[model samples]
Target: MTEPAAAPARPLRRDVAAALLVLVVWLVPISEGAIQAAPAAWWPTIVRDLGSISCLFRHRPESVSYYFVQVLRSGRREWEAIDERALFPMEPFGYRSRFDRFMERFGHRSDAARLDLARWLAARDRELDPARSPVVAVRFLAGAQRIDRARPPAGRWHKPDPGAAPVRVLSSHDLRESDRKDMSEETGKSR
Candidate 1:
């Protein structure tokens, strides 16, 4: 009788490999959270390196509101205030992404960051209308609204009306020195 042929060995399945890869990726965020919660003394060098990579995964989400004041020259003697969103739309993907990044780094007590944001808005306004001058300012707003998770699933969630939510103004920046100088020069010319 002929010897039976040995059954061919199977290679690793594609589905299994993919599942393993997903699991490893999921572990990154969990490990990052644990490291963040742990004491600084207990952190290892490798954990620090991993934490940097895990920045893309933000476990804590906060609601942020951005408000702005836009001043436009309606006449030589009068200036009009318009809604900032009307002048500068955040609907574009690139602008929205950059704004989000700026908010991520913004602090309640950081005047420098607020000044930078004001400068950026002034520059953008100038770029949009080179023939005219406008003064633009920005304020950072944030608030925390709690949800009642203890209630039934159908009605467990509650969100305050956006207009009604009390917002803390973290920072505010007005016109820069150069802008003030320009305004003064224009006033002199008008006189």
Candidate 2:
């Protein structure tokens, strides 16, 4: 059989440039992570456009945390967990519920915002089920369970155990007091 001709070899300069490009692409991300994690700022920003690069990828998956809302009705002794879907009926996706996201942002909100949220919840509770006692108080709860990274998740839907994980009350407000104050303010304004 006739011998097939060998393919032309790439130039040494071209090969070196290609290798350097690959090296730079890989190193930029590593350098970025080091720069962000450490206090030192040794990485040169002029070389790579780190500003444009999203920090979402840099987020290290922390412990699995869950946020939920509970309501204290006028006559009920025990707090009832509000159904997230019912509360946020317009929410399209379930990866994160609207109520949960609200709770996440709730930490940074002011006292006035808390009262607004409490008032909204109280009104919403009555609207959701008029037969049930009106919500006298609203409480936001947060719980986090340290996930073992080594182990695979048991199920697609993992319910964070309220019993196993320590539940924290992020904010609690008495709607009754707020309502009374609001009424008094309205009367005072009228006078």
The models' CA-based lDDT, in order, is: 0.53, 0.69
Write one digit per residue (lDDT tens) for candidate 2, span 1-191: 98999999868998999888766655655565566642224444443444234443555566766776778988888988877777777643356666656655554355676668778878887887899888898887778767677884675645465556688887888988878998999999999
In order of listing, the candidates' clash counts read 0, 0
Candidate 1 per-residue C-alpha lDDT over 146-169 given as tens digits, one digit per residue, 9 for 90 to 100? 433464236333333445777566
User: TM-score for all predictions?
Assistant: 0.43, 0.62
lDDT of 2 at 185: 100
Once model 2 is optimally superposed onto the true structure by TM-score, how far is the C-alpha of residue 169 displaced, in angstroms? 1.2
Candidate 2 collision pairs: none
Question: What TM-score number comes out for model 2?
Answer: 0.62
Off by over 4 Å in 1: 1-96, 130-133, 151-162, 176-191
Clashing pairs in 1: none
